[model samples]
Target: MQAKAYLQHPILGQRLRECTQIILNVDGRSAEEIFGYPDNLKFRSCLTLFMTATTDNKVFKDALLKYFDGKPDTVTFDILAHH
Candidate 1:
């Protein structure tokens, strides 16, 4: 499969970075320490799945809209879904 391009919007990029950072910060270990060698790629793939699901799911969208005061357009959910 072809790789998806990195998001062009700064907001989306920041969100993805924050998510990845949160995963890395779990258990007080750096991502490298936690994931080690081959598992790192698998971890990242799972992260992508997470991001995609969060964007595509209606429940998540509803929560996001509520959190951001109904500004659904501000989220790049459609863009994330395609990725």
Candidate 2:
């Protein structure tokens, strides 16, 4: 079959278009409504399908030590005072 014939076939492109429209109409609006923020952020967040974190062995050890040390002190008097 021709490429255009396959694309135009009833079971393919038409159904895909319908599903895409439904998603764009419903989920797109809901996503915008839920996460839309008017205030300007200092930086724009860029998304990547593949991301990597790099650290030296010593740096990772130091960060791990700091994280464990800082955990217990995260809840301070100021936070308790709010309650």
Candidate 3:
């Protein structure tokens, strides 16, 4: 499913797009491949799992911090921090 279907805000949608790209290109991780049957995912669970590593809680934050070059703005980081 397209991100716009789940993400209502344009800026958030853009950020999600970028995050997905970073995970895929920079991190060499496929979001859809990791997330089986992507269309069937529960929005909240999908988002939470995407933002938090199943292996370790700190991994997600570390990944996000690195993705943003270590100085991510509060609003964007806040959303990632929650999960």
Candidate 4:
């Protein structure tokens, strides 16, 4: 959840767990945080989470596009800030 302000410590602390950022890596922390780890998640929860984190929808949209596009080498799931 790349956003402006700090709302969730669990995800924030994940930053500390990672030694470096890997482009589109979707590491453990990222996977768990974004996709709810091994647990099933609702689309609404994911949507709300993203919306809460992202203040600018346009930027978020762009980032997501590029992420899925797999073109940029700089976009990392570790800290893909969209604010």
Which residue pairs in candidate 3 collide? none
Q: Give the per-residue lDDT digits (tens) of candidate 4, residues 1-83.
A: 34344334567534522311232354334323654634212322332344345553333334334333422223232334442
* Candidate 1 similarity to native, TM-score: 0.33
Q: Looking at model 2, which ten-residue stretch has the lowest summed lDDT?
A: 42-51
**Which tens-of-lDDT digit does each residue in 1-83 have in candidate 1?**
12223433467755755665555346545444666875654554444434454443443233333333334432344555665
TM-score of each: 0.33, 0.26, 0.28, 0.22
Cα lDDT for residue 83, candidate 1 = 58
Off by over 4 Å in 2: 1-3, 27-83
Candidate 3 off by > 4 Å: 1-6, 27-83
Task: Return the lDDT, model 3, position 30.
Answer: 36
Mind giving the per-residue lDDT tens digits that candidate 2 earns over 1-83?
A: 23245345779645534543443344323322533553111001100000011221233223223323312222332343465
| Model 1 per-residue lDDT at 76 | 43
> lDDT score of model 1?
0.45
> In model 1, where do residues sit more than 4 Å from their true spots?
1-29, 56-83
TM-score for predicted model 4 compared with the true structure: 0.22
Where is model 4 poorest over a 10-residue stretch in terms of lDDT? 16-25
Candidate 3, residues 1-83, lDDT tens digits: the string is 23334454668645665655555354543333555464313322434444433332343445444433433345533655665
Identify the leading candidate in terms of lDDT: 1
